[model samples]
Target: MNTSATLLDTLRAEVDQSLRKFLDLRRPLLADPDLAPLLQAADEFLAGGKRLRPAFCYWGWRAAGGGPDPAIVTAAASLELLQASALIHDDVMDKSDLRRGMPAAHKRFEALHERSGWHGSARRFGEGAAILLGNLLLLWSGEMWRTSGLAEEALDAAMPLHDHMRTELMCGQYLDLLEQAEGESTFEGALRVALYKSGRYSVEQPLRLGLTLAARGELPWMERLCVEYGRSVGIAFQLRDDVLGVFGDPAETGKPAGDDLREGKRTMLIARALGSATPRQAEDVRALLGDPALDEAGVARLRAIIEETGALAACEEMIKRYLDDALASLEQAPITPESRQALTGLAIAATARRT
Candidate 1:
């Protein structure tokens, strides 16, 4: 197997184990039977992810001359909890019904309410419960990071970046909401939303967190590499995600086809399409986009319009350019050869992945 693939698989297993151990340790604190379901929900939600953020963090540590240590893995795994918290809240905001091929957190809670005959409004109850669950996970993420056994100095060094990352995530999310409310967005506007909402936290900040932890502080070269490499890959990763949100296979992505269309996400792809669309094509988009009752036919029409307008091709080109820029930046990074190779592999995987 490829070394990067092997490393990613190993990291995934280790992260999963770390998460399980952390959750087990916390079980006693929330031991009330009434909260059993909440714990179970957390477990289930944490079970399915690519573990990419943790991998990026681990490799960033390695790139900064950090030696192999289990403590770093534990610390990196805490990112998964943060990711889960964000995803749970994101699903509620989008009013999405499915996540990872299963009912979304809110939907599950709503069903629980209905099944028990215990709520005035199952929908409201579900949304409330899911929100609380997301908050709990966010709290646990901080606790896990603090207690991951890394040296106090290292944790302290990285703390500011950690706080900033979460703040940026919230800001990005609010920008996304504002964009949706405004109905249409320019390519630049959509790109800004992508960078802040998903790109920064997903790749750059995680890598920075790891690098800072390992170095006990930031260096000029480290900052340069992260900006040149990490930022480019992060943007490309989000662009690919925009493509997948519309065109990816359901089985692979674990979401309904054209879910982005249904949600009316004002992604860069949509912006590009609208920028060049004919009057009738634009009219069709306005009519069908965000329709809760959108069907496969509507999805197909929108897909066709996106393709005919060359938006899809333009987006693909942009992804390629950004990915190339990232890979190019890696050639001169003063990191270990093994880490250099691994980072190269990670860059490709992030932008080229189907899911």
Candidate 2:
């Protein structure tokens, strides 16, 4: 089999195993009748994630010369739990109703409240239940890590990375919220947010954590390479998501088309459109950029305006540039040929993902 296929199979197996373990760990807590609402939400929220984060973590371990062991697989699974927790909270914050083609955790709770004719506001019930579910996942994720049986030194070294990932992700999320509220996000600001929230946790930290777990010594050069590669892939992932948010088929993407426009996400494409738009065009674009009231026609018009303004082209060019940078970084890394090839294939696949 080809290298990519092998890597893909390995990752799938590992993630499947990790998910079963995750379900088992939560089984006891979920058995109580009082916890039914939260438990159901948790099960639903975690059921259909693509397992991208855990796959990345697993590949990172393999790329760092680490053999696949139960501990490593468990660590990767822990990352998936963390990802699920983050998404649960994120959907609540974004006021998103659909995730992975179903009602988000908050929305599910709200529906249940309404169906049962509960007294309180359904919105509050939804948000509250989702928050509790998120907290449960966070705690469970930590327990997974603790039970991994890795050395104390390994876990200790990974602590700062873990802390950094959470801090940066939260900071990035806040930065995004502030920018959207202010209606003025520079390219630099958006890039910073993408790197912190997506790039670091999605790529750099996973790679470093895996390496640390394997007791790999200080790899300053390799670290830099990973950051560059991560930043590139992260940006590409977000850019693709932005495109899908606006143009992808709802059936395929599992969300409403043009959801980003409705949410007024200040993406790189949006920033570029503003930069390229004429004075009158700028006003037109700004009017619809953050307006939650925009209908389907309004969204289509906005998308056309962005395309006409040459912003879409600029965004595509930027993605290509980052992919190039990622390739260069991988070429510069001093890992074995096999590891380098695996990383390269992942970079290609990540940049080219249609979904």
Candidate 3:
């Protein structure tokens, strides 16, 4: 394998090990037998992921002249916990039944309630438990970062960025809900949702956090690189995700086909489709877009509309443009040669992934 690929694999392994160790240490603190199920749910939820955020953080540190260090790995792994919290909460908000091809946290709890013959409404119990689980994971993320064993000065320097990342994530999620509530959205509106909801947190912030931690403070060029390169790559990543939401195989995406359509996500693809659609096509989309009971036929029809309207091609072109911008920014970045290459590989992987 090439150097960048090898390093990425190694970084993933290290982060996984760090997560396992951290969870094991925390296990004793949650010693109650009743908490076993919650802990197990967390474990299952966390067991799968691309670990992209942590990889970005690690490579950002390396770019800033930081060397291999277990402390950094531990710090990077904390982002995974933050990611987990987001996904768990998001699944509940969307009322999604599956995640990573397994029953979603709420569904798992709902089934548990049913099996136990609980008196309360199973759905209510499930949603409440899942929300609590998400909150717990969010809290744990902060705890893990604070205790990552990095130097006091470094940790303090990075804390503000971390705080800002979490704050932005919540705001973005709210914006997403607001967009759905408002019904159809403009292309600009959809792009705004994508930028804040997933892009900034997924790439820019993680890169900035690592750079800040390694530099012990923000450098002048760091912000520029993050904005120019990180932001572009992040947006492209989310764009690819929007495509996968409709076109990806269930086996690869771990969700039912066209789940995004069922959930009525106001993605840029949808915005573009609506923009270019005929009256009949627009009517069909509006009718079938958000129906929870959308069957394969409905999905197929919607997919055809999206394709015929050229939305899929438009989104693909946008992804390419963003990726080009990101890679161009990297070419002029005054970082390590190895990091530039690795970041290039990461950018490609993020934008080109099937899941």
Candidate 4:
């Protein structure tokens, strides 16, 4: 296996351990009948995630020369819980049905509602339960971080980044919801959402948090470099996701084809296709933007239009540009060569994931 694979294995093991730690801590709290259901929901929601955010957090800690302390693992695992909360909320907002190869959190709740013969409307109960559980996970993540034994200065410096990540994530989600409702799908609009929703939180903030934890007091030009690097990689990830949403095999991606199309996601692929489409092509896209009733044949036709519009090539080209820039940023960072290599490998793995 390659170094990225090795690091990924290590990251997974560490995150699994940390997750067990957290579950142990929360086990007693879940003993309450009212809270047990919520905890179950949270745990199920977290079940199939790839642990990407926590992996990034750990690599960030390592890249900054932060030792492999159990406390650092605790902090990084907390980040993953935050991500889980965000993802659950995001799925609810997007009205998506599947996530990480399983029913989305809200859907799972709804199913549980029916299976267990809960009293309220299934949809309402599911959404409400998922939302509250997601909020609880976010709160627990923060508490874990605060109690993770970092220095005072480090905590003070890192808190702003943490807050920014949550705030910007929510704002990005709101922007997406607005775009979907209005059908104001544009390339710039999509890119803006990607930046706020993913770029900073996923890439830049994790790296900065790692450095802060190491007590490095912020390196020269770190913010700019991380932003540039993060924006590039983050956009690439989203673009790739857009591609997968349309063209990927369901067996590999673990979702039905055209899931995003059915959801009417205002992604870069959709935006670019709309901008360059002919009148008929444009009409085709507009016709299906949010048509929940669209069947497989309709989805197939929509996929054909999106591909024939050449937006796929544009998206791929853009992904490459970001990848190059991110690698360059890693080279310029003032870190040990080993750490830089590890970070670079992880970045590549993140951008290159097929499922």
Candidate 5:
């Protein structure tokens, strides 16, 4: 019997090899040599993330009575491609300088433009190229899913879920952009964004899709329970991210301290803190929350206010509550014991992570 860590370690290895093999096949086919940088960007960016989506997808299959099938692993890895596309596009929209401790795709391309002595506006060229690269990755994700070598019956069973996952992902991105532009959010409004963006496509849909692919036929009741389980874990995951964004160690998170505060993320942590802060504290937050030039002193001040007002503790409580609910449902999920252990481990790690 595989240990829980062993199971995930093996799956992660399989997913990595699959990503490299898929990228290698495409590397030789790009007609223009200059376009090579985009491939490198995708490869490196793909290499750095935690592989959470693929893990969820693979476990979903296991929970549905599926055995150890490498084909399902290959299919699950495709979600990473979709994830890459979303992240690259987000970097562009946010004008972020770094991703996963490296230059953002747009900035990378801009540097390449400068090194090549390419003409025209470097900024425009870089951003335009990055956008197209994101589009290319998006297309390749669909290709990967379509050609994953699963049975046609299984593919058909999972295709609608895949379609919805993609739709929700894009819609979530748009909603995030709109939310940021709107300069504020209500608690309910922020939850709506989390539902579609981080919660649905990232966890719930992928889990359900994997289950559907291996199912003998429709199992609506099982699917509904899985959704409930996935949604709860997924939301907790996002909320934990918000807490880490404010209070995590910079080394563990691979970003500068208070990077979210610097970026003015307007996360639930910030919203809740403001909602509960004393009048003086609220005034301090409003003056500094979105200031790009906010320094260590300013970030520390805001963090203090957040903790003093109980927002940080409140978010932690919510994560624990949601995690408990998810685990409770997972215990009664009709899945095998091994699958239950794996799912429970994933939920805990995803929520308890520092990064």
Candidate 6:
């Protein structure tokens, strides 16, 4: 029941090892000239991360009074694979130029085609390859979970939650895509989309899955408490990301300073700013928010407007409120003291992170 920082570090190491082992076994299955790159892509993508999902899952297990189990680490690592799949697909969809400080999965594949002097459209090849790779990662996530060697009973009890997590992630992704096209999204809609896309999957379900596996059945109280904590904190996590999207240092964020603005995401910040703006101000934001050719000056203008319109202040306030709620919920939760403390630290780290 020791959920210390060291324990988190240990879990991260174990998860990384488990991921490497899985990749080693799976790589041979695709042992071919054409498919070598797929394994390489997965390996590279999996190299580094915050390991948030698995951390939540592992801590949930601990919170349920479960003892340490290596199989759990192997199974929890599946979340990382799921994350990879989502990122790859999302980058492709967004046509994002960078990921984790490197060329995006699709762009890398595209570069491969160009270097090889392959025929046909390089962009298409890159996009197609990245999509297939993402699909492979998704399948591998399930495989890792299924073969993690957690007791069959635990696996069976947890399988439904696992499936639903994936479905919810996709559901959220669709909502995000929908918001972009549907113009003038409301604050409520943006918040809803954030939860659907990343909030739940990021914190709640992973914790719930861990608890479910430990209990080997449903726990009504645990579920109820986790939902509140995850919803509040999870939404805040995305909001923090939105804040970083605009104001984070590039070196810290591993992306350009103004990528979110360039993408014109209808995030809560944008929605709030628009909601509170004068007609001229709103019109100016609309002109520069998503302009692909937006220069440094334009980004500065938008940032100033966001700050001046009180949207930046409002988003920060919302994040603080949600984070406070999440921490308070954990205080009264029926879990181990160690877990509560670990989760408290995790709450701050996830929401207050610079990257």
Q: For candidate 1, lDDT tens digit of each residue in 43-144?
A: 999999888899889999999999889999999999999999999999999999989988999999999999999939999999999999999999999999
Per-residue lDDT for 1-355 in model 4, tens only?
3466776777788777777777778898779786776777677666666676776666677766777777777787788888888888887876788877788778888998899997879998888877887898889989888887777777787788788777888888888788888888788898987777776677667767776667547766567656766567777777777788888877777677888888898889888888889999999889886787879888988878777888888888888888998888778777766567667776776677475
Best-to-worst order by lDDT is: 3, 1, 6, 5, 4, 2
Error of 2 at 197 (Å): 1.9
Q: Model 3: per-residue lDDT, tens digit, 49-103?
A: 9999999999899988899999999999999999999998999999899999999
Candidate 1 wrongly placed segments (more than 4 Å)? 353-355
Off by over 4 Å in 5: none
Summing lDDT over every window of 10 consecutive residues in candidate 3, give the lowest-scoring window.
1-10
For each candidate, the alpha-carbon lDDT, in order, equals 0.92, 0.76, 0.93, 0.78, 0.84, 0.88
The lDDT, on a scale of 0 to 1, for candidate 4 is: 0.78
> Residue 138 in model 1: shift from native, Å?
0.4
What TM-score does structure 5 among the candidates reach? Answer: 0.95
Best by lDDT: 3
Error of 6 at 256 (Å): 1.3
> What's the TM-score of every candidate structure?
0.98, 0.94, 0.98, 0.94, 0.95, 0.97
Error of 6 at 189 (Å): 1.0
Query: Of the candidates numbered 4 and 6, which has the greater TM-score value?
Result: 6
User: Global CA lDDT of candidate 6, please?
Assistant: 0.88
Screening candidate 3 with a backbone cut-off below 3 angstroms (N, C-alpha, C), the clashing residue pairs are none
Q: In each prediction, how many residue pairs overlap at the backbone (N, C-alpha, C within less than 3 A)?
A: 0, 0, 0, 0, 0, 0
